[model samples]
Target: MTEIEKHQYDVVVIGAGGSGLRAAIAAHEAGAKTAIVCKSLLGKAHTVMAEGGIAAAMGNRWPEDNWEVHFRDTMRGGKMLNNWRMAQLHAQEAPERVQELEDWGALFDRTDDGLISQRDFGGHRYARLAHVGDRTGLEMIRTLQQRAVALGIDVFMECTVTDLFKDGSGAISGAFAYWRETGTFLAFEAPSVVLATGGIGKSFKVTSNSWEYTGDGHALALRAGAALINMEFVQFHPTGMVWPPSVKGLLVTESVRGDGGVLKNSDGERFMFNHIPEFFKAETADTIEEADRWYDDKKNNRRPPELLPRDEVARAINAEIKAGRGSPHGGVFLDIASRRTPEFIHKRLPSMYHQFKELADVDITKEPMEIGPTCHYVMGGVEVDPDTELSAVPGLYAVGECSGGMHGSNRLGGNSLSDLIVFGKRAGEAAAERASSLTERSGVPDDVLAEAEAEALAPFDSKGAENAYTIQADLQQTMNDLVGIIRKADELELSLKEIEALKERAAHLHVDGGRAYNPGWHLSIDIHNMLLVSECIAKAALTREESRGGHTRDDFPGPDPEWGAKNLVLTLNDARDGVDLVEKPLPIMPDELKTFFEDK
Candidate 1:
């Protein structure tokens, strides 16, 4: 048996992103011994990749913007599939959370009136995103990190958690992890575990997410007997760099469009005007003059089609590219040079300027950018209680992108940061309360640890094993080609068969080197998570026969009223190797909240 190092904490947070840091801070402040375990170094979590801004209704730029308005926009943006309570709570608490960040020493851009500046984003009725130019997420992380350090929170960096253990009563006991540097096994015995691990974008070939986002939290929750919801809804951001294969899926911040950039085709035609769906016709401008005017006089005119929700924009871009109006690089053009001056572009979008100039040799001040949709965020994850952020599994919690029901079908730009702080704090408080209630810490049985150790070391003992990279590449290609932004029943069915085959291949994965600093070994473990989560996504997509936000089925072609009233929930089957899908009715919205959508 392999000896394992052990430690104990009241609460363990698995991830170091904005949500994890915030949760650790909340747990520590609540007098719980909290530890944050992450696969990467501190401050290098995927949240730093967010370049747009944080969505919060501070009413800094528009006094009419309040929680009610924000909530309405959120529900509408998600295509009315959001959990009403979560949306209401998020809208009500986001402002205070943003203010708390400022009090904790984070700086944000200010308006002419000396208030925190707000910017325009798709699906928002008013300019509501509080940002620090194009690096709001970076500033948010710096502030959260400083606060956590000041509070003396414990953080285990460069550690990967592979399995979560449960006590005899079916409550969370602790987590089994390995150090990335030496692959030494360690275990934490904690009453409460918070899974703040982010999304599953890395499963796709062209994505904006980094390698760390391999569905760790989702798969962990599933394996631990927790249910998952909304696995079918995956967001594809409409603006990823298309030229230069090295940076093919790199994100082009929506801030570019919020700051006056427009999308055009190879013929220099603003094509978004031609693709406005009937659902948004009342709020979207039909002509260029009206669309351009709305940027300045938002009160009197409708929003531009260029600023529609990400789902609409991505589909439109795909349609244009397929119709042969795309740029030379098989994408459309995003133009800001003709709209904004060079100095203004430099001040407002410095990162974008540098990213394009250094990587693609494109100057935003003089030329357009070739961009297309790239796999971004997954709206599906561990099903959690809206208030406590607790999953179905006792003593386990989930937040940020790893928890479902907050954003129903699609998440709006900027909402992700707010979701982190708002629910991060809630989950932390709940986790601490649960920890305090437990009289004695649970212990992991020796046999469980031994089984985990054997599983971890299986790659070395397999005969006629396949290469991990080949299986991963095949999985990515399958997901990208068949289960991408546009899906069909036939393709989704095909994807499941392919995923099953890959799972078989992954079981016999062979790594050539010892675990110490071995990228192949790390991938071998991570591929299991990606495969499990991918199966859930494919299965749910095939079951839900409708086209909605973030989930478009070519066979259905449009949203179904029956499907809109229900959400698909997934759980581990009896065999414990596959997921079983069931439909649950959508949460009922109260009368007061329903009033906001009466006329619309």
Candidate 2:
């Protein structure tokens, strides 16, 4: 056997998406020789899939819109379960971060006065999202990628991290990874590691996320001795294509509604009015005329039906479909085609139009779009203090969807973009600073290296006749059936059992390729990440017996204040078969932002 080659760096970033790119850039700016390793090509990380816009309180459209109001909306929309500090910091810094993107050559849509244009979104108190029509994520990522290349940060594309290396004291050391193009293992010995590996949307059957979003960062951190918090709260995007099984469950951008689309059922009736939460009731219009009037005159009133948070909207849609009010296409009608000219609609949501055309063979310009909820974002991840982005483990960090607490229970549309920018930079800065303070005199532990090597080669060596594809299919179906939009104790228990069985099957999974650019082998490895993350979500779901945010349990139909006051913690058990769930105390906000939570 050939010896594994090891290289040293100040910091290693384990993703190349929006947060990973931004984190790598920040580490480099902090005087660290940083490198980014990801599972896809440069500029192709799932960040490119975000179609809506970035939430920022730039006040370009309305001067009264500021970070304070943004913070209030975020906390209230999330039902006040958000970390007050992270929310405050995000609202305060997002404007500057957005401006920085502008300085880096990101071309957001412009207002009449030449400042960045803003758009209305669900759960927002005002028009706070800075956008580039649609394709905002593509614009942001492209800009960041350009900046990262210019900074000369080493980028290893199409690489996936198997595990994080830790020393005797259990502090994070670095990571071990293999090249997808070549079957070579290279050890990255960095004092600090930042995991910007995104979310676990792939754990479900219907999802807007791509193949790369398998919660790799959370899995890596958990194995390396970090804790994941609030894994129960998984966001289901309310608007995804729901017809033609092939394109079913793919996200249809919420930006369609932001641009003035409306939702209708089979009988051609607007239904969001029947499901408006009490929180938005004060601002919501009671009638269709009122909703339309509120839409036309945003300054005077509010559009409650169109303004529900993702969790509420998704649940509402699910209820409608279950009641047989769904359109013939197994979804509700998103009627934008009749609301505006095709030219204007295309300008606002170019990719949505193109995606529907190519995948569903429908033109959004002339037809009402069919949409339903799909697993979208996760609000649970590596536990961190809102300001530092540091996990419980030293020298470890997390950002983006993989690191949670920013969105609280429910994530507002558009906030994820700015959340990535704000916290991604924080993690990079903190990791670089932490690395600067530490000495890398001691090398990687022997057991850690041995375990990593075994993991890296096991797929090739396994001749047990298990198919990774078959196992992966079962996993997705299991998660979808047991842990989907509506949950119950019996279903969650079965989901855990099914995950354990699937994981057992994974050990014997045999790949057909020799690792050199072998997608099959890559998937075999990725399934481990998916299994671990799905378990985390399952175990956390089993523990939290309440209907709050994204975690709605049918058995426990009401939101309990006692359950609401804590974070769900998932720690790895002995066999790594599953995680141990615990209810940890939620962080008390600093004095300045306490009122923003809307506490009575």
Candidate 3:
């Protein structure tokens, strides 16, 4: 029998990104003996890759900007499919959270009057993102890390939790994890478990997500009897590096367009105007002159069509590419060189300028960037209560990118950062409270621990000749090709069949070498998570016969009101081998909140 390590905590928060750190802080402050378990070293989470800024209705740039307007914009941006309560709470509380971060020493860029400055982003009615130049995520992480350290929060770095354990009553008891360095099995015994693990982007071939994003939290939630909502809505960001094959799919921040960059086709025409949807025609500028003037005089002119929601823009770029007007590299050109000066570009977008110059050998100050859509974020995740961020499963809380319903069918840029802090704090506080109410921490059964250990070591014992890396690569390719940004029923069905075959291959995966520092062993485990979540996405896409936000069915080609009124929920099947999906009605918004959408 392999010896297993054990630890006890009032609350155990998984993942160490923006949401995890924030949740740990909130839980610690709420008097819970908290421990944060992360897959990477502290401060190296995917949160650092976020470049645009944090969204909050601070009214720093425009006094007319407030939570009401922010809420309206969020609902509209999500195509009104958002969980009304979650959207309402996020908009109302984001300003306070931003101020809290600043109070905890996050130094945001300031206006001329020394107030925290705001910048424009897609789908927002006002300039509302609080930034630290282009490295806003880095700054936020640094500040949060400093606060977490000061609070004396416990952190277990480079630890991966493979499965969530439940007690006899079906409540979360603990989690089974392993250290990456030594591959030692460990169990966390806690009354409350908060999953702050981020998105499931690594399931796709071309994505901005790192290796750590293998849908671990989502899979854990599903297996633990929690439901996942909106699994089909995957966000393919409008701008990503398309040249220099080695650097393909790297993110190009929306801050570029937010500042002044324009999208052009091979004919050197600003084509976003021609692709504006009817829903946004009243608010988007149709002419080049009006759009240019709107940058300086927003009160008089409508915003540019280039600033349309990400789904629309990504589809427009896709349309332009298919029509043979794409750039030489099979992408469209994003020209900031012609719109802004060298000094302005460097001052406002130093990271982008450096990224292009270093990675793709293209200087943004003098030339255009070849850019296209790349899988960025998933709108679907573990379903949770709006106020507490607690899932249907007791003692299990979820926040950040791992939790669903907050973004609805689509997520607006910058809202992700705000969602992290707002709901991170909420989940942390709620988790701590739940822990305090429990008489004692639930114990991980000896049999459960042994079973988990055997499962983890199965790859080493397998005699089958299957490579984990090959299976993972094939799965990524399958998802990218068949169930990508544009989906069709026939393709989705084929993708499901492909996923089923990959799952069979994954079961026979064999890893070589000792467990210590074995990357192959780690990937073999992650492949299970990727395969599970990818099936949920493909399954949900096939069931929903309409286009909305991030989920676009090419066969359907447009949004259907009947489908818009429902959300697809995925839960673990009885056998625990596959997922079962069901449609549920969307939560209704109150009359007061509904008034915001009446005129628009």
Candidate 4:
């Protein structure tokens, strides 16, 4: 039997990114004894990699901008697949959250009139993203981390939770975890658990997400009897490094395009104008003259087709590349040098300037960048109530990238940072309230702990022929090739079959060396979560049968009105052997709110 260390908290928050840190702070303020557990160091979360800005309708750049326009834009961006309540709440509260961050000492870039400076982003009617140049996420995370530390919140760093335990009544009891450094077993006893474990991007080979994004929260929620919605919707950001094989999938921030950059092909043609879909035709500029003019006066002129939602841009880029109009590296060109001055480029995008200079040895000040699509975020995750962030499991809550419905089929560029603060705070408040109401912490059953220990130790016992890294690599390649931005039923089905085979290989995975700081052993567990999430995505993609948002189907080709009215929900089968998916009607939009789309 493994020796198990035990700890108790009123609420246990998993993943210490922007959302988890904000959640911990909120839970503490609500008088809950909260602890945050993470798989990495305190400041190294994926949120720190965010380069654009946080979307909040502060109206600093334009007086006409407000929450109503923001809300309408969010819904439209999502293709009307978003949870109405979540979109409403996010738009209503994001400004207050941004102001609160400022109150907490975050130094945002200021406008000429001394208000927080705002920038333009796709699917937004106004310059609504408050930023600190191109390092908005770094500043946001730093501010939240400092605030949480000042609140004296407890954080368990370099720890990974393997299993979420439940009480006799099926409410969340606690979790089974292990230290990444030592692989020692431990248990968390809490009445409530907040999962902010981020996205599932690590499932794909080409991704901007870090290794920690292995879909732990999505798998954990499903195993604990919670539902997952919109699993088919995975965002493939249009711009990623395509040169210098070493850093192929690293992100080239959308801030480049947001700040007057233009997209061109090998033929020196602006191809985005030719690929504009009917869905956004009315709002997008078709001519170069109109696109350039829109950058200066957005209210009077339509947005550039290059600034379309990420899905449209990604697909258009992929098509351009396939048609043999790509750059030297099989990707389209993003030119900012000819558009903006060197001084302005350095002042606004210092990180991007340094990234290309050091990594690819290409100076953006002089030439265009070769960029292609990269899997960036999963719009689907654990389904939760829009107001409380509570999943079907009563005491289990989810927020940020780990939770579904906020972004629906596709997420807007700057909305992710805003989602973190808005829903993170809501999840924390609701979780703390639930935790305080519980009479006592639920006990972890001895049998459950024993089973978890056995499973975690099984990889060490296997000296089998299967290599964990090889299996993981194959899995990533399979997802990237078959179930990526462009999808087909045959490919999705093939991907599912490949996933099953990989799962069998993962079960027999073997590793060498002691349990102390073993990377192989950690990967052995991570593979399971990755496979489960990948299966969900492929299966859901196969079933959707329509092209919409981030999920584009080659077979189905276009969106269907019937499909737009429903959401696909996935839940664990009763026998716990497989997943079962069902379609549910979308929440009805009120007549008043529906008026926003009346013109369309």
Predicted structure 4, TM vs. truth: 0.99
Q: How do all models score by TM-score?
A: 0.99, 0.97, 0.99, 0.99
For candidate 1, which ten residues in a row score worst on lDDT?
292-301
lDDT of 3: 0.93
lDDT, candidates in the order shown? 0.93, 0.87, 0.93, 0.92
List runs of model 1 lying over 4 Å from the truth: none
**In candidate 2, what residue range of length 10 has the lowest lDDT sum?**
591-600
Clashing pairs in 1: none
The residue pairs that clash in candidate 3, if any, are none
Please provide, for model 4 over 50-131, each residue's C-alpha lDDT reduced to its tens digit, 9 standing for 90 to 100.
Answer: 7899999989998888999999889988999999999999999999999999999999989989999999888887889999
- What TM-score does prediction 3 earn? 0.99
RMSD of each: 0.9, 1.6, 0.8, 1.1
What is the Å distance of residue 25 in model 2 from its true position? 1.0
lDDT of 4 at 597: 80
In candidate 1, residue 463 scores what lDDT? 81
